[model samples]
Target: MSNISQLCVILGDQLSADISSLKMANKQECLVLLAELQDEASYVKHHKKKIVLVLSAMRHFAQTLQAQGWQVRYVTLDDPQNTHNFTDEVARAVAEVKVDEVLVTQAGEYRLQQQIDSWQSSLGCTVRCLQDDRFFASIDDFAHWADGRKQLRMEYFYRTMRQKHNILMEAEHPVGGQWNYDHDNRKPPDKSVPIPPPLRFAPDQITSEVISLVASRFADHFGDIDPFFMAVTSEQAEQVLQHFITERLVNFGQYQDAMLTDEPFMFHAHIGFYLNCGLLSPVEAVRQAERAYMEAGAPLNAVEGFIRQILGWREYVRGLYWYHMPDYKSLNFLSATHDLPAFFWNGNTDMHCLSQSIGQTQKYAYAHHIQRLMVIGNFALLTGLSPEQVNEWYLIVYADAYEWVELPNVSGMVLYADGGIMASKPYAAGGSYIDRMSDYCRSCRYKVKLKTGDDACPFNYLYWYFLDKNSELLANNPRMGMMYRTWAKMSDDRKYEIRNSANKFLRNMS
Candidate 1:
């Protein structure tokens, strides 16, 4: 048997050079095992671009590790003898090379964590699950902060994180005398100003090979596989981040919540695709934005809003995901049971908003946050789509989606599936909200101004229908009192018309 002291298993998502498992390992004594598993790629029919990104990044990371003198046993999915799962691969690797222990960073999802937990017994070797230190806060740290809290709100948790990390801080006080500038960041789409497209990298040889592999292997998956230009290396990812800081950060916050037809990137930083995969570090991205602000390169509203996304919302959601797991995924507070519509997959709907958002997703496997939350997710909330269905769709369609981030954002923040754990109320909205935020209504077949009848926007009646249906569960929520009072004030005939319009639309959709 070959003499190896440890077998460090690096997952596709754990591609960072400084991940915990690699840090604790001696380059000479450790055999770094990076595998492209079939089971992982097909877990939920991930978008073609997502598969390409992960596999390509993994291959590039392996090259980097090897160049740094680390011994790596890379497993390609096409290997005839490959076992196609983590447990079997680890077992095979250990049997081939005698190792004293196996080291792995804690998984980002509950399902994978359960499998990781069973490895010690199955492999008959000591298994060390290292905490993922890539984040600003540890899982245990989040747990400690969560204990004894009556309400787990992100704003309070965010303030503490800002203080702990000293991001945008002026000696214990937040910079500009404010902790949040979300109010200044919600301007509707400015049609006059030109939007700078996110920088795209030409597929290098490594990524081109991954693209061909995904195209053939995952031919049936969602999204287009060709024209895949995302950064697959840490250096490339950093370039993308720098591009955003220079060309896009000034306009990012203002148009962040706005949507426009055929404009997918919209001045928003697309680095989440890199950051989620460990090719880019969250803290580094936040620091760069803060630097830009200090240098007067970007406004405080833009800088703070961008920082809040990474340092606040991204970290907050990850904390919430781990703090409440296995049980958290099953929470469906509204009892939403409708199936995800077929149009979500093909973007064949007549609603221009959904068609635009989903069509963009189909081509690029991405949508801006507002397109995700207000347009698509809001429709799911109003129409009572199954949380399971919506969650899977969100996971499948987005390149940045991992269960840790996707679950809380979809089930908690978007669908209100976790009751009030992550959101004060369901992110429900009427057609007018979409109309005000986007130019989609001008082209939609349905009338945004109409509240009832065949041509009325489905969101209009469905919003009230959702509120009326879930009144028993949500009527007492202090934040929802205004909506409830408005519903109560509606004449019985008006309410009937809304319910009828909603039921009719839902039946047709079904």
Candidate 2:
């Protein structure tokens, strides 16, 4: 067995059998190491389901490795000897196994990657962090692509990725004459449209045990642990992909940006939990959507928009995260410093949209994109919630959140905290946008049409208030100029009323 030639460290996120660290590992010589670390599970108070998902997937992956004849050393969270962090575990493994080298897939988080990079010299053994090949773009590849670009726009980067990967392409041209179908994909949810609940999986013994462990250990965590139905293995994740393509993909684009009172899923493929965990490959997911379009006659708009998310926005965000992290996480362009309202965690609010979105998040650890952007995120931006607080809340609440993906989306796109890296302007909206796009306003306790009264929806006045208060920082922005002009043209009395209402709400927000 070459006297423990290598110790292969598999992280919770790096569960794929085809992960780079495993590609050259031999069953006879390599020892696979999987540990449930308290440090990771407790970092930022992850959603209960997220913890269960990762631990269950790690256990199943370890079992899969053993079935393939690889020598596996698995450490449960409750292991009496568990030191509760990666570095200590790795140190113990190297000493006990007498391995000459360590092999690991590059960690998704920058902090973890820095630690892995430090291991070789510290451990006195050769440590290799193989490039994570699950992504279509390598870190270096994205860096090279991003070199010297004046503005890092997703649309341009996405187009380049399409050409490089030859995805949805015909010869040298894109399959469609145009690059984006986003305009066509913004239709409000059709109440007449019958939305199927996403496919659910009953927990097996492995997952059931994980649920118990997470529940008892993380009882104070942000989200609910019971009624757990997420796919914890690649096989089950594939079933989710199949369900999305066959049943929901056709209408996914049409209702992609829509939200409703009780409809959280709304034709949105809830497969991000799978995709971010390495259970589903981004390339394979997009290719399936493309195939569905060509073979099953799915609309081009639906297929293109779905493909754009995985191929375009997902890849673009990851690249941006790696390109400007550590610094990126701290950017707060507008100096937003208000504490996040407690209602975010407990969902105790009179606003119907916030109540529904936050309630669903607590229950399922999922919310569709628009609900995230226009509801929770928009409210955060308009109300001047601290970027760090808002960013951490997003990281804490979602099952699919890892720092790389969650940081960019929250700090850049959601809050415009990176100044304009992910967006030209902050996605600041009022109740009108929510009312038009969702059914939440129809039944809201706050009247959507009232702009300044006690019964007025907070969003109605908050939207105008944000524009006026941030005029110094945002007025010169070309995209924001029109809103500034509208604010400029408003009667002084009306403006005073709006600003006063917003200030009153802000002062009382807790």
Candidate 3:
């Protein structure tokens, strides 16, 4: 009955201790392979913090496996025997240690999916790429939910999830008697409200070593590489989640769309990386936030809004990824084509809003939700870069830029490049929104309200220019009809001036 005939692959992101593969290990029979592949890091010149977090977590997980009496063939990026790639290293391990099958939880990426799926023939063994099963839903499970639906909506899917998991519910309904509490969550953060600082973890030696390696290897990559500190382990992830629910979840929804001065992380749970890398489960994160609300009568807006994001929006994004990818990544209904400005790479810019947003991106690789959606995404939308280019940039720039989730958020939700498939209409805007939400406008030399002038806000001119340029496509769309009507009232000469000013801004940027 010696069943030690299978090989289990433990990827860097697959550090979850409760993963079925670990519990399924036969101790003496199966070997878990964790390889540090060069291709993974260099694929996009990923952020330094992302590189350090994964490598450090992998080492710790390998030790956890070893302590549990499972054989772990841990290979470093610089290992002499390293094949320098994931599949090559996995194939090498499989051949050197004979196995009947290779078991794995699926990778949350398109590039790796093709690699893993094809390796079965090369290894001359069955490759059982099982579902990651870490999410509240899986690709298969989500597909099942999508079956026969005329159109998909996260609200409906999320309600199904709530019922299926019996979370935040009373008998058959959501506890608040309605499926949503969106109304309460829209209030901006009050100056009188005292918010707590984010939970921080000291960079242990393991993490510090990874940082050193990243610094040495990727000295020329875009974005900041310094002062990297956040969750790197499951314990750290849990502690961060705990702090979020107890101290911040109550206000998370209210200020979810609000922006504040000098606060990047803010009430936002910087736990996306943890959830993305498998340190935390989405359901647990949502459930805990819900629990905090019930126990403390936390504002319904705050609780409901936070719950909807994780249980509804995050899951919806994942399902959309599986439902449409490869093709989804290529959809550019708007047909936008321009270069992302040089200012995006470094924080060097005179436009205060752009400078501040880019500066935060350099410092922490994070921008609050509004800053991302209305400012960065809005700017990109108006300037009109090809969807693929903008998608690639977003995928590489953020801490949470895994293609599975980031693509739709960028090309579809952000750029409106997928037309109306992923969004009802464009999230178009002018600069006044940014002015209202941030202090950047005050410091900015450009005039936020000016549509055309030597120093008019490029955002204002570009905003009108984008709408006018795309009026043929957007004018009839119900979501934007009102705006288009307003546009129709504007003089033709004003439209000419806005486009002219926007052109100058782009010319100057280059």
Candidate 4:
């Protein structure tokens, strides 16, 4: 028996050079496995950029390891002998290589977690799941902090993280004698502000081949297929980080809430894919932003807010996903059952906010945070689409979406499906919210000020209907109760008109 000593499995996303799992890799002793199976890509109608980026990055990472004298067994998507499934592929590799030990970091999805358990029994081998130390705040560490908290707020968690990491701190206290400066970061871009051009890397032959493969194989998927960006390598991802800290981070905290016409990226840092796909480690990314605050005259709000996202919220969501797996994906507090509108796939809509947010996603496989939560997620919630269906749209559409991140954001925080685990209540509202935060509503065909007329913005009607329908589920929420009182004081005639206008808006092709 060959008794292959180690089975080193690399999932598509873990392509980092300094990953802890790669520490024990050896040429003759370990067998490495890489698979591009249908079950993984087809689970959600994957964005075109997502498919190309992952495949190209995986191919590049495998070549680097092989060049360094490691034995790699790469299984391509169209491998004639490929199983096209994760469990079957793991079994096949173990039997062929005669491996007795399986070594890997914990996976990023719940389905994969279950799959690994059964795979172990079939292989009759010892499987060791190492901690995914890429994140500064581990799941164990968060659990320790959440032990006695009555309500888990991101701000509170963010402050704790500031002290634990000693980031932005000054001699046992915060640098500016305060934990946050969010008020300082909300200025709109002005005459002096010119948006910096986004960082673009020239595509190498390796990434070009991956784009060609995705175009050929996944042409049926909805999204723009041409003008694919080359984000497949770690070096390019680091360059994107440097550019943001220097040219954009100062304005990032301010217009982080603003959106403009034809300007898809604005001051947003487009590194979610790189962070999620293992091209950039969380610590270094956070450190770079902090250094900018110390040395490069970046504002406190810009530095602290950017750092909180990575250290506080990103880690919080991942912990929540693991703490309530398999079940978290099924939450539906409002019990919505409507199909997603056809316009979501094609971005063919008169609603300027949705068009910009959803269309930009198809074009770039990216959206800034406010665009996602306020525009798209808000529309889905106000219109009564099922949270599960809404969650699936986000999972399929973004290059950075893994189950661990997507589920909590959609099902918990954005949708309020877990009732209160991720958020206190549904973030339901009208186009007025969009109008205040962005430029999208200004150019929309539907009148943002109208609530019950032919020219009424659909969000006005949907907001009332959503409140009426889910009143029983949400009336007592402390934050929402005041809104309920306001709705109760409205005349019956106006309420009737609003609901009627909402129904007509939903029914009409207009």
Candidate 5:
């Protein structure tokens, strides 16, 4: 322990009261640093709502710390002395406060982590970056698990996580007979009954101020600023979580993969932003779902399915991100190089699925996982859109998106650019899959049944075209051999028609 005061550096995402930085530093001896830098807010032209959510949450967290009698050096985005970066702010704060030591939590993104790792020499202070205890699995633990594994699959990793955490486990065995309920969770979209809305919070004064600031500063950014009902505080986030458990979790599993026109959130918990922003804890979220299964009698399929996302997919992606960074971003296994279309920004495309998903994203800064993976992401994969271009769009558009989570999901899982590191096979599906799972096909300008005619859905032909084009690379995979065999059986004329249709769609996409 240092005799002098410790400067606790709290990043925007590290808003929790139990964060490692806060825990290690005494309130009386620590001066908390929370800055809203232009450099971070404008990184990749972030969605306006995303900027508002982070800034507002940070402001609230700082106030909460102050109520606990902690001295906080809060820097607003408009602070003229901000110098627009964490490096300058940390240097200025240490020099001004004359703190001898600095305590900080590890950053979620690698870029910021690099900057933090260098701060000790630059700031003339003993800097200690404590492990962020937000997640169940630590980076070191994940590394140990990854070692000597030929293929790192989420199912096996998820089972280990379950046992390690003692969650949904019965004395070394899973509570359920199976480790996954994914098969039961893929029911088609149903609109027979009205879908209940997720909980929404009206903007408080702090959030309103943030909205105004983001509106003026990031006017050209994608997504609507109004109707910004995102839960900016931990209390509000918990309310939303409780609401999901009581009203929505029962059906969440079955319809998790289903999509409907203009129905952005169908039995989905819109807690990604909250979870990522530190408003809610992942472990707590999992425990709550498990409790619902036991006490509230929520279906095991729904509860387990929801828990898998937070426990399995979320943790796996973060681990894989750290496991393969600085090199993972550049992996273009399929070598996709096409440009992202303008419709990604404007939602002006004739494809109903794209228009619905993108428009929802523009309005809410949200889309359920299926809309992301199957609709926008699927189209991007089949169309050969540059992985970098696709990755940037996802990073910018979603409120929950951070580089660690978004990059793996986009470059590795969605685009298959990492060559099956994150996914077993390319989640490639034709329009028929969308038709079966969503209602977008009903309203689509293109016919889902048509494979290659003028009014045919681009996904129909593009799905086969993607397979045909990448057969040399993908055919060797055990999971992809059947698709290759099917493609080989197709007549030359039909194959040509599919290829020609895909080419025409790509040409017109520009």
Candidate 6:
């Protein structure tokens, strides 16, 4: 048996070379453990592509550590002796290697964090759970910023992060004399504009093996495993980042909110898949976008918008997740109880917007934020889908989704199930918003212009339906006053038609 000083556990998501536990370890004395466990893979029937991405990334990262002179213990999912759980694997490793301590970065999800919390008593060793410093704001840092604030807004938190990081700052003011250029950035998709495809990497030998394993074992999973083009290593991930900075950043902000049919990767960075998994650093991605602006390679709207997603929204959701967790998972501020529609799994819906968004997700395990937030997520919101089911569906579908980031976005932003904690008002919108923002409505069977009848867009009536049903909860909200006033002015017969249309749609869905 090798005499090891510590067993450093690097999780599937914690694949970064600069992970805190790895940095704290004496590479010569500590054994690095990277395991592909069945339990984690089967927890929610994750997309096959997501499973392959994580396992392949983990395997590649293990090789990187070994080449760097660290002793590594790699466990494959198909290994005969695998216990398919973290605690059991850690115990087995502790028994095999003479180690005095177990060092690990904090788990990204609350359920996993509970298991990590028990390692000391169960493993009978000193278990050190280090803060994941990859993020700009630590859990404590966010809590401090959130403390005593009646309203927790991403804009204020984002300004603080920009100032703290000196990202777009010139002394006390922003470079463009504005913290946000979103007004300049929301031009609807111009079909005439040239759109570059996201950079795709051919699967290497290690990733090929992972694809084969996931294809067979998770044949029933949500997404297609093959034709997998995700970057599985840091070098490849960096290539993706550089590709975005050069090719996509200039138009990323302008068309960020716009959606086009059959054009899945239009002017989007597609780096969230890499950034969330620790294959690429968020700070590095943010800095590169800033540099592009400084070099006149990309516009201020593009650079600032891209940086805000990572520095502001990404960090904010993570902080909110940790701060409100355990109980945060169960929040149902709207008391929504509808089961997730079966269409979410297979993209079998008449709404072209949803079908396009979900179909893209199933094919690639990727969807840009607008598709997620406004199309698919907005549908879930208006339909009164159960938050738990909605949250699980999101976590299962996206490669970038972990509960820490996914839950807050779904519960608070999408479902409004967290009340007003994450958003001032629900992001509910009618088909007019979709028609204006996307090309999906042009092809949709539902009439985007109609407000009632079977052929009318479900989103049109459902938007009013959601507001009416939740008026007791949302009526007094300042941001919702205009929407309520619009509703109030409608003739009683008109209101009845909207409610009836929504009811019929909900019934048909069930």
Q: Identify the runs in model 5 with alpha carbons over 4 angstroms from their true place.
A: 1-4
CA lDDT of 250 in candidate 5? 92
For all candidates, what are the clash counts? 0, 0, 1, 0, 0, 0
lDDT of 4 by residue, 303-383 (tens): 887888888889888877877777888878778777888898888999988998888889988888888887888888877
Model 2 lDDT tens row, 1-510: 455789999988888889999996766789999999999999789999999999999988888888888899999899999999898899998988889889999999999998898898888899988999999899888889898988889998899988998888898788878888888988876899899888999999999988988989999999898779999999999999999998899899988988988887889899898899888888889989988978889999999999999999998899999999779988999899999888999999999999999999999999988888899999999999999899889999999999999999999988988889889888998888888888888888899989897899999899999888888888999999888889889999999899889989998895
Pull out the clashing pairs in model 2: none
TM-score of each: 0.98, 0.99, 0.95, 0.96, 0.98, 0.99
Model 1, 392-499: lDDT tens digits are 999999999999999999999899999999998889999999999889999999999999989999899999999999999999999999999999999999999999
- As for TM-score, the candidate ahead, 1 or 3, is 1
lDDT of each: 0.92, 0.90, 0.80, 0.83, 0.91, 0.92
**Local lDDT at 185 for model 3:** 57
Instruction: Compute the lDDT of residue 235 as modeled in candidate 1.
Output: 97
Q: Highest lDDT, which number?
A: 1
Candidate 2 versus the native: TM-score? 0.99
Q: What does each candidate score in C-alpha RMSD?
A: 1.0, 1.0, 2.0, 1.9, 1.4, 1.0
Let me know the TM-score candidate 1 reaches against the reference structure.
0.98
* Model 3 per-residue lDDT tens digits across residues 1-510: 245688888877778987766666666888889988888887887777777778888887788778878888889987889977889888898778878888887888877888898987788998887777777888777889888877677788889988888878899978879888777655654667777888888888888888888889877766776777778878889999999877887678777776666767768888878888778887788878777877878777777777777877788788888887678888878888888787778867777877777778777767767777887888889888778778777766777668888887887788988776567788888888887766667777888877688888888888778888898888888888888787888888887787789888878876
Which pairs, if any, clash in model 3?
4-29
lDDT of 5 at 333: 98
What's the best-to-worst order under lDDT? 1, 6, 5, 2, 4, 3
lDDT of 6 by residue, 30-112 (tens): 99999899999989999999999999999999998889999899999999999999889999999888689999999888898
What does the lDDT come to for candidate 5? 0.91
